[model samples]
Target: MNCESIRNQFSSYLDGELASEQSRRVERHLSDCQGCHAQWLELQQLDARLQGLAVPQDLESRIVAAVGAETDAEQQAQPAPPPRGYRKQVVAAVIGLAAMIGLLAVWLRPNMPPVDVPPPLAAVVVRSIGNVQVRAPDAEGWSDVDGPHHALPRGSRIKTPQRGGCEVETATDAQLRLDANTEMVVHGSSHMQVLRGQVWCQAAPQQPLTLGTRPPADTAAVPDVFVCPAASEMQVRVDQHQAAEVGTEPVRKAWQLPLLALPGSDQGELSSLVETLLANVGHSKMQFMNADQIRALGPRGAIPLLMYVREPSSSQQPAVRRQAMQLAAEVADDTALTMLDELLADPDPQIRRLAEATVERLSVGSAR
Candidate 1:
């Protein structure tokens, strides 16, 4: 036989399905042609590899069960008719009596108490203060929250007034701090939304948590403290004891503030640096400045930037406003507090909301 015809039947020949004459022809061709012999060796290798594969543990049982159930169903659906005879009527009567007895037994069965399915565990409010309210997913409006250790369900919303604040412990052992005038919605054990206000979160190292202003578009977990700001729906990751401001843009070094790293330097040099940084806030090259720069500036350096940001005419950008608010928080002092108060009456609703939250945080810090 030609080489092409012999090669096509190699698989069948390997499986012993080829006729005796065809198998002999293929073997003779392999022996004569070195190329065909190499091809035959490859086919043998492939067969060996396939034969060495292990079947899944449950595969055989699952296949048998599926096929058996299908056969039984088909058989039951088309049971053979009994031979036409006088016994047909008797069989019908017997079947009718058996069905009636089954129905009666079912009707007389005693009713058992319903199973008590536990509610899904969510975050617990470990601590709270004045004006803190919660609205469950089922509830329409806000209601006074129970004092402390209140377990909230998914879809529940917690709101803190101007003088209110709270701490929450999530199921994954993560800690969340909600500042005053903040509203947050619980999505699940590891997910939540910051509708308005500031939320400082530290997730467990092993099981990171997720925080977003809206439902997360991705399901990846983040292993960092997330700072969610009001107005702009974005999450900013910050280190512990560090602060950051999240705006419309992605997280950058400029938004982060390393309070501990600030140098105790002269105020004049810091002022010039702050001015330089603010001037470059919107520029592509200087879109952000690191916490070290801001910390070096200290509260004094942050003051001028705050004023420039709060100015009604200075580039009404959300990024500028958010950075200003964050810088104000870092420089939490009388002057910053006064600016935040002025921001309370700011025309932008988001800026006003953020200002209220910042004021609450400053008040808390001052009290401490």
Candidate 2:
């Protein structure tokens, strides 16, 4: 990139707002261009100086008191009300003065604590399949939520019965798909906790999404997919995809998984790291290192790493098994179909259920 182009993006670069490619280019240019580098240093110094300056502790109160005194003096200096004929004008002026004083008092009120604002509604149910229900925060029981589209209130709990699923569109236009026999509580527009079952999500450009779950009892569990969208902030969580048994009845409803539109980037070194981590599966140190690297690698590093986690092993840690299920659901790759199929015959009921959900998710993702 030219010096002019690098200079134009200096502010964004300083704020870490530039894309990786652009940031790299700017850094390379700065290394070879002395003038631009000097300019960058000046900007950094100026920012540091500004941040170092502190506001006077009583500045607000002092300003308010000074303004109030000035207002009172001005009023006193003004000529007295002319006569009875000007009575209406005098009354209006008095009312205005009182209103001003009231406003000033409010503005100068001390020790007022900040109020917390709840996150705004970030998504709405855009589609629903068999036996989906919602329980509002104020409701005592689940109400059947039947339709093509509906607005889900914040703090509501949603459930999909056997053979059921649904899709939600987030404010950023990202899509989240829930698998059958799943339950989750919506925390905010961009955040939610998966109580049980799996969720498939695709983030909008520059709008990262987060899904939180309880920490696993087993230390070997696979961590959750903390999806950071293109040029966005990072969010992390642990994966816990354990399933619950409802009954002996067979699932009759069939729902397709939502199509995922992930960023197109080769895994490269990340894939190698994931392979090494899997080869050393039971080693805690290796697992920790792998988790750190995957997080640093971002969304592009999700797929095969998660696929490795999904592979079932009788000697594998419970935490690792659970993590694989959850990450599989998050990534939803078709390649996991064989492993998921094998899990169907596993003795553990919870693993079977988790595998079933993951299969559905992968099917949908693969279809797309």
| Model 2, position 196: C-alpha lDDT score | 72
C-alpha TM-scores of all predictions = 0.31, 0.35
Residue 289 displacement (Å), model 2: 42
RMSD of each: 26.4, 21.5
Give the residue spans of candidate 2 off by over 4 A. Answer: 1-119, 216-225, 228-368
Candidate 2 residue pairs in clash (backbone atoms < 3 Å): 220-320, 221-319, 221-320, 224-239
**How much is the lDDT of residue 294 in candidate 2?**
44
Q: lDDT of model 2 at residue 336?
A: 53
lDDT of 2 by residue, 1-368 (tens): 77788889978866668887776577556545657766875665455434434445565455556655665676688865345545445445555565556556645887767544332354677777678898776679998886655666567788888787777776656666777777877754555667676565555664345454544556665423233343333322123434222211122112232212112222453444444455334233225655555455443344444445444432367666555445445544565576568768776677688778878776766788
Q: Report model 1's TM-score to 2 decimal places.
A: 0.31
Model 1 worst lDDT run, 10 consecutive residues? 252-261
User: What are the lDDT scores of the predictions, listed in order?
Assistant: 0.59, 0.57
Stretches > 4 Å off in candidate 1:
1-118, 215-368
Worst 10 residues of 2 by lDDT: 244-253
Residue 135 in candidate 2, Cα distance off native in Å: 1.9
